[model samples]
Target: MIRTFFTAVLCGLLFVSCNQQQNTTSEQSATQATEANVYGASFDAENVISVTQLQDAVAATDSVSATVTAEIVESCQSKGCWMDVRLADNSTMKVTFRDYGFFLPVEDLKGKTVVFTGTAKREVISVDDQRHYAEDAGKSAEEIAAITEPREELRFVADGVKLQ
Candidate 1:
């Protein structure tokens, strides 16, 4: 009978320890960003290149695979579907998730530093698409209409993103 009671206590203790809850409240997660907050496919954030190096690499080729750290100039306000991260030369490059697989929280993420791994390429965005992005960003009618011309710009499709 003593052995049975001891075994029962041990099992209870194991259950309690195994079921320990994590502090993952939304408030904590939203406000607390670290290297642990990884979105999409996981990749090491090491050996990261600056956005300028990524730009130069793609300037001569169709695309280049790299991990880049950049500051957010703007983010998709409606759905967090895309972000315009600032480059070293003051230009912004659009970064989108690979395969539309993951999305960031819809919030004002301007000036936030983000590290991402993916393929950077140069692409010409159509006027219609540009207007769509402007609208998604909550731009005014005047701002959206001003994007009448197609833009040749640097673009990145990130497979993984680490929010910092």
Candidate 2:
């Protein structure tokens, strides 16, 4: 009789432990969902650096991994494939998603704040590409024709983004 009683107690304890574990998992999922408007990949919106800090880092290194908070100066009106953000130096840099894995909503998100995880690098954009981006931004024909010179600028490839 004692052996049967002990067996029953062990089973009850096991059931309770499993039930608690399941509840914890569900709670975590709920928290993540309510955290932010996650896009591309899910990441905790932490360790965020400023766009000014990003400018310094980009100038100092060829590439750096970071999470940055910045305001959108412009976005791709055509496909939301990329965005331009103002940096500390009063210049704008283009930000694209890594591997075309995700895209932002096709709307004018200017002045909206966003936090994203990505890598930044410096590169020289070709004249053709510059014109292409201008076209995507719905520039005037005169503006598109004026993009005759290649420009060097900072660029970012974000694997995850959180539109705040």
Candidate 3:
């Protein structure tokens, strides 16, 4: 019968439409999940400079906003509040979160490459602050006590950091 054929065709079309919609929804969810997995501030990697460039700028006493990509040598073990990013010559810069807003995962960041977008400032870190940071890094008591003098270093306050 013509009616039977038409009804079957309509049902087939409806089934196909529903299947396609479901697939689309599933794909969107997966994409969103992947994007949400990235940590820190969202940053464009194109303008990122090398750690050596940042170091040179610091040596020249240039305080400016910069994007630098470097390997994380260490992170604060207590709360992941800060990290030490390494330069090409094995120098390290301390990176802290902006406005105390966000912290990285302490254990998961070591040896990972990250792009930081923020300002690098040259400042003297006091003995107390150095010892506190050393303790937070899980350093031994002797190591913490070794921080007896304030030292000038490059400190970066990152508005956003993206793991590469």
lDDT of 1: 0.88
Candidate 3, lDDT over the whole model: 0.86
Candidate 2 clashes: the total is 0
Candidate 2 residues lying further than 4 Å off, grouped into runs, are 1-36
Tens-digit lDDT track for model 1 on 1-164? 99999999999998776665333465456654553578788888899999988878888899999999999999999988999999888989999999999888788889889999999988899999999999999999999988878989999999999888
Ranking by lDDT: 2, 1, 3
- Which lDDT tens digits does candidate 2 get at residues 80-104? 9999988887789899999999999
List the lowest-lDDT window of 10 residues for candidate 3: 35-44
Q: What is the C-alpha local distance difference test score of each model?
A: 0.88, 0.91, 0.86
Task: Give the per-residue Cα lDDT of candidate 2 at 132.
Answer: 91
Q: What is the lDDT of residue 55 in candidate 3?
A: 82
TM-score against truth, every candidate: 0.78, 0.78, 0.76
Model 2 root mean square deviation, Cα atoms? 5.3
Per-prediction CA RMSD (Å): 5.0, 5.3, 6.8
